[model samples]
Target chain A: MSEFKQADHKLLVIPGPIEFSDPVLLANATPGTAHTSPAFIPVFGESLKLLRKVLESTEESGSQPILIAGSGTLGWDAVGVNLVQRGDEVVVLNTGYFGDSFAECLEIYGAKVNQVKAEVGDIPSDDAIIKALSSKPKVITITHVDTSTGVLSPAAHIASLVKKHSPDTLIVLDAVCSVASEEIKFDEWGLDVVISATQKGLGVPPGLSVVLASKRAVEVSEKLTPQGYYISWKKWIPIMKNYEAGKPSYFATPPVQLVYALNTSLKSITSKPISERVEAHKAASKYVKDELSAIGLDFVPKNRDIAANGMTAVRFPQGLKAPDVLPKLAERDIVVAAGLHKAIVTEYFRIGHMGVTAVDRQRGDLEKVINGIKEVLGKNKD
Target chain B: MSEFKQADHKLLVIPGPIEFSDPVLLANATPGTAHTSPAFIPVFGESLKLLRKVLESTEESGSQPILIAGSGTLGWDAVGVNLVQRGDEVVVLNTGYFGDSFAECLEIYGAKVNQVKAEVGDIPSDDAIIKALSSKPKVITITHVDTSTGVLSPAAHIASLVKKHSPDTLIVLDAVCSVASEEIKFDEWGLDVVISATQKGLGVPPGLSVVLASKRAVEVSEKLTPQGYYISWKKWIPIMKNYEAGKPSYFATPPVQLVYALNTSLKSITSKPISERVEAHKAASKYVKDELSAIGLDFVPKNRDIAANGMTAVRFPQGLKAPDVLPKLAERDIVVAAGLHKAIVTEYFRIGHMGVTAVDRQRGDLEKVINGIKEVLGKNKD
Candidate 1:
């Protein structure tokens, strides 16, 4: 704890760009290193290898990890451009704001999208998804954990359903908010693609779009005429293969410092069994949810089982609003997110507990959050 | 000098991901800050304002600076998707590798690209450009400095020619290798768009696609249906405007740390007159060219006037190749890039003198590069 010498600032308890470890921050400060230099190549290669371990995917399963310099939204573009051709059928399992946006993105790229949308704070019903799947969509996208609503969809069940019904359909998981905080068995769950970014559970600065593609996904991409220049899988696949083989390659210049920071965070995350990390998040979530429940708060997700472990979306107490609680939290040096999901935009707010805040209990970050909320609510009651 | 406490490593003299200053690297190490946090809003806002100052663009002229989380290649995608609709006629003035690639990118997005080609290490002839413009292309693209061959095209001249030949044609400058290192008066030159990245003349780690678009470009983009999701001007324009107004807004997440580093570098770069920085690059380019010439080496560019001010592409002396010179320089803890142009790949190499290397004389970076080159060439002669 003493080694954490970062300048004093308010705790960033937002869903992403979460608190980073000291080592990760220092790694981000790496001196300028050429993307193709021998020294930087292995850093990139190891990061790729470690990503496989984190997702429980393997080269043996023909899963490839891609790290590009962009936001996670770019991951949606990669899917829309590389996987879906003009007028191809795609089923988007709409959980929250991200689902709507992903569907819109696929539509822009000419995908004929059928979105299965539930009411806000809930996942689409299995019956609706099966109905959408019966159309034999070319791809089905699921948001593992939608940050906007803190709804954790049952990914494995959906993947199993997809395999049983539309066996040839690709299963794409938007794991931007779930990857390091939740249990993701990419190969075991039969996920064809998992799209993510570095800032959330990965505990790095926000710059990289981290993605994994199955062999079938890559093969389908190869058959298509490249629609976008920067997001083309055909160009990036060779570069990823070369870097992972301990050789220097280039499609475009990578963000050198961000990759270094990602490598450092991956090492720390993979140091322990990923299951242990997921369990730690579960513990933190329980702690936070139980405390908030005691304060008479209702959550955005319909039930405990559906809520995300890394983040919580809590509705303001009846008669209280963002102005009343959020400002008080800010005064306490804590920062949480205002609610998204246009259906209930002003009803709730979000707090993120992932990475060091959840896994490193010595930091007592969750306690700070719970106490700050309690104090704010206590004053409101007065 | 005492304030520079970065870890000891080989100097990065490549054209991009060049040596960053201590302040910029340290800023990159900033603790996690949310993209929309009050603390970060000003950093992002100031960076946008500073970018206009660096480019000599003003809000009054309706020029906008866009900073996104991607490489310079993404800038090409933005132009292709935003400005070029299906069957749009565009002219690419091919100087080197980047020109061909930019044309390829534009074509992928449905532009009918007409490329005006020149021989290796030379800009396109005015007559060829005029001929291409006779088609009344929608846009004319120029690589301000093609990193592949170190050829610095006369961007102002081309923009003026485009205006004369086809008044409605947009002028796009790919300044990936020339932004802060060269003179660019966006309004004065009537450039509709200038595409760049942070790693090169900006002296920051690679991750950001920094672009500037004129009012006409924005208005033109708004008229077209967005072709790409992540690079959409319609989506980003509001976000950029909101941030510049010191307000928190989001389209996709910005790279918070990279934006911080970019702000640090931009503040430093704009501290003095931009002309002074350009002249420094000029002085460094002349010094390197003179030293190499004295050592009996020629350059890829046809003459000194047309060569890039930030980097030099020098041909190996008789019987010398990259293998004979680059590895020797690497041994001296100096790193440079091998030649990239396919036509003269084995005959030359590129050395970057930008940012701190070109501007901070106390660092003696250029002297070290020249001395190392002289030693490597002398050993080859012996």
Candidate 2:
């Protein structure tokens, strides 16, 4: 914690690799330790349990969590390789960039996908989704919070619809941007697979892809011969179980230092009421939207209610763009990402309000971001 | 650099997750940095360039290198998903556990595998490999230092033989344990693929899987409709190319902190003569093997000539086993791995002398390991 929370550099607010707590960063600096050492085994085992709590669940659902050394994209691959097999029909409730990428990944694994695409910053409507489910797809993937447009979809509502209409279909939610900062009830929502990365709301450095799967999902995975080796649930379920049971079994070497950092972040996230964390993110998000809205700015999402709690995507002012604004903010030591929605990439920018930047208000990170944007947008000239 | 070094802890001398350098470890603790920020872009780009040098390659061969946020096992899946499509015939030059594991991974991708297995502590005979190749396998895979047995297969020799017999077959080498410590001339050897991990000879913590591929292999990959998504070369090739040219292109978010650590480690490795580093490993390995043999112990390799330079797998003393000797060594603050071969897991142990532990004789890490083993093996009885 000795001056390592953030180095002598600008703030990172690009939605991922977010501002981390000092304790979490220090944990990343752990010395070289044996992956299977007695000291490390329990730490790993406990971290898996903590992941369940952060996901807002207990082990009673017969669900399991995984920590793999890869980015969030690997989670899409995991869902595709382990579940679809060849010629399986699936439906993608497309929201933004991540949804499109997931469709591409699933197609590579021989899944015949029917995409329900929404306009920018909008989620697929229930009417469209219900119509698509008529095909009796084997899986339905929804991006909980698409980083490309800061579009937060209603995951629980969709899962319930899926359950009522097609109970056999697995629900795969891409929650890369909405794990700790947003609400997720892995069991109560009847979610089957939740795929996320550590760089976002988890408040840890990137390197790990955290995936949670339900009992039925695992049973379905066990029956298929996965088309991938590293992406297979069959190879990893046993290892995840063994580690969670205080023993060491490895299908592949886990990332030791990254896992240490994840353990620290998970402990901090789960020790407090997760609902409080969600409230904090909501407050931070509202602050940014309110301040920007007063400046005559518009958001990518259809309305404030549909915007992601962890981030906001706002259109640039007339006669201004990212090239004109980002550098000015960087001059003030504030960093925000340019819009990533392929169609509107040059039209808007995104500000992330997840992790410590959202919860640890004492740091005034959101205030700095707001102040930086005001100065850059020429709103302070009056 | 500000006192982020290892604390009072035992030395890690396992086959991998070896003792990392202070600079590399400090880099791993880097504070939050945006993955696509100007500050991080060059670091990521330069790391890729340095990786090619470490693998002893030039772009002249139309070869490319990759660094993904995963363990070494992902490399196997990368090759399987990219090169050998389902139903492709491939031959595995089985040396030990790694060979069998690679075979299993390929088969999962629907490859038809013919494994030419070797006896314990040995590699597949050239005659056996030639016989297997006569059927015109699409790929010939070799484990360039099977960690399970410390048997270092002759990669160049095998590649040459494969080319002579099957002119169209691609040559793949798993160099997870041999990358920096062993000599691998990608261009000179006419090899198609060499897969490795960061934790072993690279002196970085475990997380990334580094792979180098030739033009011929890439061409084969370009023609295939890969079976998986995240591991596909088609998705990564352009991103790797863009980053190398100082342009930002996102495929999946890379592991930011791990890539920073790799950049530091790569700079240190590429700034000096790589041959001297290989020589250092050779000397350190000879010292370990000689001392153990003088004490009446044997290695898992058939002889000293075939053993891996980065590590040594030694049979336990006549009157002792891992339970007797490993704990004593641990008490002395030295950590070594027990045997992992399926048939002889209880008969031996492994000591790693790669990277800084092998190169920086000033550190005296190898001396500590030798002294600890001598003290524990009852060598002071006289």
Candidate 3:
């Protein structure tokens, strides 16, 4: 019996909460240490430092990093509560479901949202963002990579546009699915706030949310306040400052084991050039797309350049529901996600290729998925 | 030399994030698994079932349990967002820091808070809570064990009072520090909402917040229009229903590795006689208090009956800050928490003796703490 049953066995090939590395998984399972214990601080500090490197941020040398205990969705609330005051106009560059979620959160805080919607598989152009910023919104929110549609936004270009057209507007980028999969240049690209998660590209289990902010984001946050207490940035900064001085403090009890797993995963990333890891994701994504092309299926995103290296959204054959195809794939031990947006859920399903997924063993899993999909379709065809 | 130099070698003797079993630690450190995988659901479902058993709540058998990505603090917000509405009158039974935090979260959601403050070392009497509930508040919040002062409130008594005085007022119990250490009959005690954490009594890392709500609490939450999204109880119930039916869904990515660790920990707790674990905690706490009395030091909560078995709060001798005695204890490979509340930071320190700490070996460490305190006080007096 092995003390457990295999009827519960599932292989996740979905967008986020991807498979974890053995060491990382073991690290996650480790018992927790006190947040302020000498054993925990170094690991916590090291995790923050490595995150700064992963995001390529200016925050490493100057600004403090705030790690909150929630989903990446909390980042939208944090930014809105900390920087967007009542009646403040915010421009949202919408690429997928996450962009709409961000806009909704901002609207809840009484911020007027002006959205520039990008096509399903395409990122918003710099010209569109520049035009939107002509009205001088206080903040410009961009989705670096939208997990919902498997699209990667042109964050660097949008950041440049914001800097050139509206210098005072803060640029917040959602890098939840992109941080480990794609190249994020926070300092070079002038990103004010870069949001990430433990799942997805980081290869850790979900639970903790990482928000890396520039000095400008912190400075702007001080000028705003919201009724919400749990997602308050002002409440987190002082503790983070204490952390920078080598003392760990908590606004809430943190997910200690998750952070430990993240530390191990972050260290693994730093062991070699991070770009190589990003390229591995790129190569796996390309290999899957090549297979998809051979299967006579088309990718949801028409533009190859805008498609994220971490995940791919493909339109299933006409008349077959994406939901129906998911369970069929599951029968073969593969897990894939249905499209998030209501507009496309029936037409498309997403395949995630992130974290330790590009390795030889995982590549074999990907190959299994490719062959498995073809087999299922062959069996279903009349 | 290790890649990281400062290793945490001290035993955690604070109220929470206590020492865990080696097996539990090892289980937590094991690599991650996807939460939605067929393998994860059975474990997750079994863990939920076992959790209800630990709580002695038959009413919670089929009621949905949501494991959110955060500490126990998130539990308060979850309750507030899901059940509280603007202009609702809420009664707070405050004994320590966490009680105040709960009140703060409720007030933010526009609830009118009426606080019934209990003395530092005393649990509020049923008469006092009845008096507070005279206004017919919508919800009544109390902590089962306040980590700040090591006080265990008469939660069942308070719940009984609420039922008598204001049946409509839902009784919410913060069991963050007491769940595994003390005997709690959630259904028998008439507790509407029981909030607990993975670190303290559960013996897992601090990442996932486990909440068990009664049928009445869920009914009240269904009436609420979801004050916010991520903390929405409405969104969770349907998904939980779907998951229990064999189709798992997630609002945000859960920490997969932490879930694995929690699963193992939950198994251990329910596998053995539940009374044995509770008795171990009580015996360890008695030993700590007896040692403190033998050393001529006074305990923080004077009344032994109202004190929590998970931790012992002690008064630091005059001429020394709690911080001063902490380093000496740390030097002896033991860790204790300095005073937390603004009102008592200089005069107190907390020693946690929960989780695996109930075993015999912990007594040696407890003795070391007593000696460390004696030496520090003697040196400072000279």
Candidate 4:
């Protein structure tokens, strides 16, 4: 019964399910830990500490991490619905797909979205963003990395622009793939909110979405009109306060096994300097991009400086499409993602080198994919 | 970096995290499975089918199980907010502390609660419930087993009474700790909704809560006046329908690791006759109760028939407090729960024996707890 009955050998080469260390997988199997034991509280408390560390929050005073069950997508809804009241003006820096998703989530709550649109694969200039906030929005939202197109926005720099332009507007960052992969200084960047998922750089399985809120974010949430009950920040803050105070009141039952896995993953992050981990992802990304170049492939992002360090976006040769190249790679048991946004879908494919990914566990697969692409395109190279 | 840090080896002899099989623990460590793969869909589909079988529902009809994050407490909120609206009258068969909690959740949403109050450890009679529902309330809520006092209410008999008397009223059953340990026939008894969690009888680490809905329950939920988005039954029904149609939507990121563990635990339950598993729990309960009788202890609930097979409630001999007994048991690495409801706090303690509580797992631990209690109470054993 304990054996991996169905999917034992099939590797999950998705950006997530990256090559997790054996220890992280074993963490989910740790026997029963009391949910209310004094021993368990420190484990819970330590998890938040590591979370803040991973996000590179300089001051200890930002919002504490609130762990909820579900996906990073849920985090978008939570941030939008919790603080954005109906008729509120929210400025959105639309770098790629996820920024528009955050905007759509805001629209669901009846907030008006003002978009500062960046060209595909390009970062939004501080001037363009400053002009967008001229109308004085109550909130300014942006993505740290648009996973859809493998574009990394300069969140820390953009956040400073918001602070200088509109001090009253809350700055929310979607660091779903960038918190542990890229350098995100929440406190230095003047970020009011940050959100991420477990499956990404945190190196656990999917389920829990972690949201870190600033004191300003908490204050704004309290004054905002009640957005319904279950997903409300108003309902969550008190419960989280009580949990930190050692009175466990669960608004929803946490996925216990997933939390256990996260607890293990966070403990590892705290043990090492988080900056080293970020550098490791940078090194892996360089390795992938370097190998692709050795084989004569060009990167999709024209400006290489703006490319995400956790994953690489590369275009197929002019005649070859992703649909044609993907299956050829799959024949060797490798899986890479097709481009996600409307503008890039026919042009590029992304290879992730985040969390748990190493040159060792995956270099062979990466080589096979590179060789497969060469063999197929090599035929046309003649 | 993610390895299993050893938890304080405190055995959760509490109502949840009850002893689980070795294989079930190992099942959780299995690697990620595709959420949409044909290989993975049947695991989801089969789990739902087995759940229906355990509840004795029709394969073609009856209630279908919808899994979500959090504990059984969320299930109560989902049922209350979805079925009861402002000005709706709902009757609660208040047998213990959880009954009061169920009523409180309903009251939060503007439903008027009509409680058929029974003393702690007492089950309301069918006639009593019928009389309370004479006003034709919209729903009648009851706990299948109140973990507080280790009492099993007559859920089937009561659901039958609701059908006979208040035909329009939906019957909601809180089967949190009792579903896998005891018997619940949803279709045969015409119960509208039954909620349970993974930590108890399902024998996985806590996180997922299940709310199984009948056709009538779904209809009532759809008719609710302005259901909130997060906990809306309407939101779930469509997702569940897609799952049934062989495609599951991303309602929220599922706690993937916990889902894997649950699939393993549930498959074990359905591999054999469910009746045999219920019988095993019954045998274990009787064995523990027999040992308690040998040591001159008295059980709290009046009838053995109504005592929960999952947990047993017992009053210590006249001068002994459970506070003295609980820590001593903990010193021996065994954990047990003190009373939960206000009325029974000083007089009783609970020993849970569900979820992978086969004879081998229970015999040694049960004996250690019983002997620890004997040693603590030896001063007053007269």
Candidate 5:
């Protein structure tokens, strides 16, 4: 299955732009193919089908997956411009940087966005979400895992609460960091929309933004005229449906090479059980957390249950900053991300354990990260 | 410099997503690099410097180039949301499909758009543009080369006229199909914005929307707080400034691998003089156009001067259609695009001869396309 070997480089343990698998990286180097060709049609069609599988949904489930030539952040603009009409109220559950950005994006479309912020390492409580819903919002957005803090919200739990309290309100989850690694029961949890990207947990290189929405969300999108030509569902839905039907269509030129890469990555991901993939991420997260614990490093997230399985955000010990640790880690050929929270930008670091870095244990990327962190902290400890 | 070898596949002669070179394709398979790493910061900073070189502008000219993770279409939104305010009056020089799309994008941001359209395969006359400018628009958009009909507008001439008529109006050029292959004197022509993408004359892949704006345009953007977070220049300018200054700053996670590919392509392009590259493309375009003339295939563009050097949009012979010609070309392992102008979508086809297909004559991609077209047309001609 692994026909290509990845180029040798530093172990990328950053939150994303993660270590791409050999197949995924090589697929991106595919020869130029027409967006409308018969060869490219099946690749895109099969990719759409596999996206449903990765999200644990089926044709009968009335869900649609959208793949666009953009980053995870553009998915926010797509959701904002399409679903939330001007002057609509949206409750943003701000766990970290992504939540704040989403709320900002929604407001750009003239929506009144009220954010329910959590403590530095925690997600908003269920009571706070319920309280926010009493205002009768048009939509409620949640970040499944905030990349900045490595905090995984209880999405299924909050989704249940929205269904009960705000039956008409939509529930959108920014799963940019959580999609392939976390369990997202779309239909079971009554999710209205899920926003993600290929780079994070899908094992694909960074580019395409992936969005999935339920039947209700689709129904809502069909009725509203969005503000921008590029972000309008009125424009993209037909193109996506045409591609899924094994025909060529265009609202704008699709990124043909990235689609090939996504297809290869999706095939590799679906070739194994989805349950196995999540378990693999879980196990690796545990190993990294245990390793960090053994090194006397405390995590940003208050508890392990709330920590994201795809990545870990750990605080630097006293007297050491991002430079002392990050540069030293780079010297050891391991790369990680610095803190992103606006309040404590330089206090912590993030290490990703998603995709091939976690599943392909034979690659030993996790071991390299552990050793690199150990060596750095050992020398720099106060 | 050509150390890598690309795989053999069908020659792509579509308008964009043209055939990639050995080094360009290999640069895409790069291992994961952190967006903020010291190793990556210089690559991005240098790319910014080279972007100015290709545009024939100097750093002292107060022109800034934007690199974002999206398609060429997103470049329209970037200009729309950042430069044009709501309820602003704008004039769009309509040449083909892209003209209509950019007008629509501007309208989405609440601009009152006036379009001056020419007949199919032709661009608007200065008389028509000046007549439309009587409305005193806040901005005027011109497509440098509309991919739909392969019609290259006289952008510099129009900008000069607009300056004489409405000096306050911003001049935005959609250069998605023209950028590197065509001459754009940003500083000398007093152009405001040029919107482009990587997959075109820049010779990178299809992600990364590249937008360049003048200092005057920057002043206008700063004076207004636009809607939308993702496309906000207020948010992006600082991030771009940071990247160019060799600091790791983030508005969003860029497509790291694609940027690596772009860095390589830009190095290859700027290694030689811009005049040399444009001359090569013009020479190749003249060859292809002359060869098409010998076969009695007429182009959609009305005149040679108005025709784009990057691609040729040719009307099929009387007895042939897209199915008859395109598939036959594909059977010969050559691929081209069908007509994109809505009125004549089935009557013509496009052949791209930009980037490697235009410059790297040793690759024989242009020869393959010419021979394949000749074979297909020779068999199907009435």
Candidate 6:
């Protein structure tokens, strides 16, 4: 323990860019290290290996973890340019804002996107997804946890459906909001790809794009001519393989400080059983939703079963919009997010309870958020 | 100032991910801040403004600076997908490896590329570039400093030639290794785009791709239907405009911590006159080259005038290779990079003297590198 303390500030409870651990921040403060330095090769290599553990992927499963220095959106570009050729059909399970954006991205890359849109605050129905698969689309994308509405789709169930109905269809899960907070069994779920980022449940700052591609996804990509350079699998696959083998290789310069932070975070995350971490997030989400419900608040997700473990989206009291609630919470030194879905942007607000706030009970971050919301709502009631 | 110290580690003297100042590293250690937080908005806004100052671009010049979370190579993709349509003719001034890679990226996006080849360790000749311009190519790219060969192309001179011969052609400068270490007058030179990254001369960790595009370039990009979603100016232009006006905006999440580091570094850099910083690099380069020449060492760049000021590529003595020299320097606690250009991979090694190493004499880093190399080679003479 270095006894270094960060300066006190407002608690950040956004859906992503969640609160990070002290050791992770210290790692980010590292002196400059060359991306290909002998000292850094192992750090990069270890991070790749640890990502497999987090996603429940295995070398035996031929799942490769690709780490790139970009935001989570870059992972979408990776999938769009590499896996989807011109005139390929992709089915998007639309849950919220992210699903719509992902569909647009695939369309830009020449995929004829067939979106199975759900009603507001709900997951897409099973029948609609199966019907969309009638055409035997080349790939299907599911937002595992839609940040805009706090809806957690049945990813494993959807993958099972794809396997049963359209055996050749590849499953791509946008796990940006759910990676460490939710349970993701990559091999067991038969998922072809899981796209994520560092800031959400990984408990690091926002900079890296983490994508895991199964053996089948790799094969599909290799058959196509690459359309983009920076996101091409052909350029990055060898680099990732060499790094995970503890060798120095370069396609592009990795973000040294962020990778160090990720290595420190993954070590702490894998120190305990992943199931325990998922249960912790479940407990935190349950506690937050129960407290808000006691205050007569509604949720963006229609039911508890579909609500995400990492965050909660609660509708405001009658006659109150975001302006009436979000700033009041900020004044109490708590930071929550305004709603993102265009349909209900001003009607609800979101509170994140992932990573340290959910897993480490001693932090008391959940209590601070709950109490702050209670006090503010009490005043508004008067 | 706070008394926080990073742990002692080996000095990083690579071309990028160079030695960062303590304050910049401390900034990278920042607690998590929401990308749209009020406190972070100004930091991002100020970073955009300072980037303009560093590049000598002005508000009146209609030049826009875009900061995204990715490596320097991502900047090449941004240029490729945004500006080039099918069968657009492009002339690439091939100085070294990066030029070839940039040409490949453009071709992937459907450009018909014409590369003007240069001799090994030399810049493209003016006569060749003039002949290539006869067809009036849609765009021409110049690599400001090719890190592979340590050859510095005359960027301003190339822009002048392009203006005289092909006035309508867009000029894109790959300044991945040159910005902040060399002088760039964007508006005065009539340049349309300058692509760079944070790690090189900006003295920050490697996570950000900093690109400045002129108003004409933006207009040109708008005329073409976007082929990419993540790299599209349509999605990012509004976001950048809003962030620069101190408002919250989001297309994709910006790398928050790295942006903070960039702001701190740009403040320290522009705190002194930029000309003074350029002169410091020049002085450091002169000293390193003189010392090596006195030891009877040859350089990768054909002469001093065409050599990069931030780094030096020195050919090994007869009968010696990288294994005989690099490890010897490492044993003395000094680190230098091996050659990267394929044509001369084993014949030479590189030493970086930019950012704090060149600007802050108090650190005495340049002296350590010079002395360590001298001692190692002195023993080889035996």
What TM-score, over all chains together, does every model reach? 0.98, 0.98, 0.90, 0.87, 0.97, 0.98
Clashing pairs in 5: none
Fnat per predicted structure, each in turn: 0.83, 0.83, 0.59, 0.45, 0.70, 0.81
Instruction: Encode model 3's per-residue lDDT on A1-382: one tens digit a residue.
Output: 1112134445668888787776776566454478886677777878878888888764444655778788887777777767877799999999998888889878877789999998777777778887899999999998888888888887877788888899989888888888888988888888888888878888887888889888878887776655467777777778766665679686787677777888999999888888888888889999989888877888877778888888999989877886668888888888888778767877889888888776445348688778778887783342
Looking at model 5 chain B, report the run of 10 residues with the lowest lDDT sum.
B1-10
Indicate whether candidate 1 or candidate 5 has the larger lDDT: 1
Tens digit of per-residue lDDT, candidate 4, span B1-382: 1123355656667778666566767766767554544445666666777778778786577476887765677687677657877789989888788888888777766689998888777788777887898999988888888888888887878877888888889888999888888888888888889988888888888777777889889887877743344456765667666666678454445666676678888888888888888888888788788878778888777788789888899887788787778878788777787777787788988888887654345346666666666667673364
- Model 1 iRMS (Å) reads 1.8
Better of 2 and 5 by DockQ: 2
DockQ of each: 0.73, 0.73, 0.42, 0.35, 0.60, 0.73
Provide the lDDT at A234 for model 6. 95
lDDT of 4 by residue, A1-382 (tens): 2243344444445555455556677777777666655556556656766687777764347466777765677677677667877799998888788787678767766789998888888877888888988887998888887877778887777777877888889998888887677887777777888988887788787767788888899888888755444456776777666656666554545555566678788887767887788788778777778877777778766576788888888887777787688776666556666667788678878777777664243536555555566676674343
- Count of backbone clashes, every candidate in sequence: 0, 0, 22, 8, 0, 0
lDDT for model 1 comes to: 0.92
Better of 3 and 4 by DockQ: 3
Give the alpha carbon lDDT tens digit for every residue of A237-304 in model 2. Answer: 88888889989676788889989999999888888999999999999999999999998999999998
Off by over 4 Å in 3: A1-11, A60-63, A124-131, A317-333, A359-382, B1-9, B60-64, B125-127, B272-276, B317-324, B359-382
lDDT of 1 by residue, A117-234 (tens): 9888898888898899998999999999999999999999999999998999999999999999999999999999999999999999999999999999999999999779999998
Error of 6 at A62 (Å): 0.5
lDDT of 3 by residue, B1-382 (tens): 1211125456677888887766666655443456676666776667777788888887334445777677788798888788888899988888898888888888888889888888777777777777888888888888888888888887777777787888888888899999888988887877888998889888887878789898888988887776566667776667556555677776666666566667888888887877888998898888778867766677777689888898988887667676677887788777889888768868889988887777545446566665666666663243
Query: Against the true chain A, what TM-score does chain A of candidate 2 give?
Result: 0.98
Chain A TM-score of prediction number 5: 0.96
Off by over 4 Å in 2: A1-8, B1-8
Model 5 off-target regions past 4 Å? A1-8, A379-382, B1-8, B379-382
Error of 5 at A186 (Å): 1.1
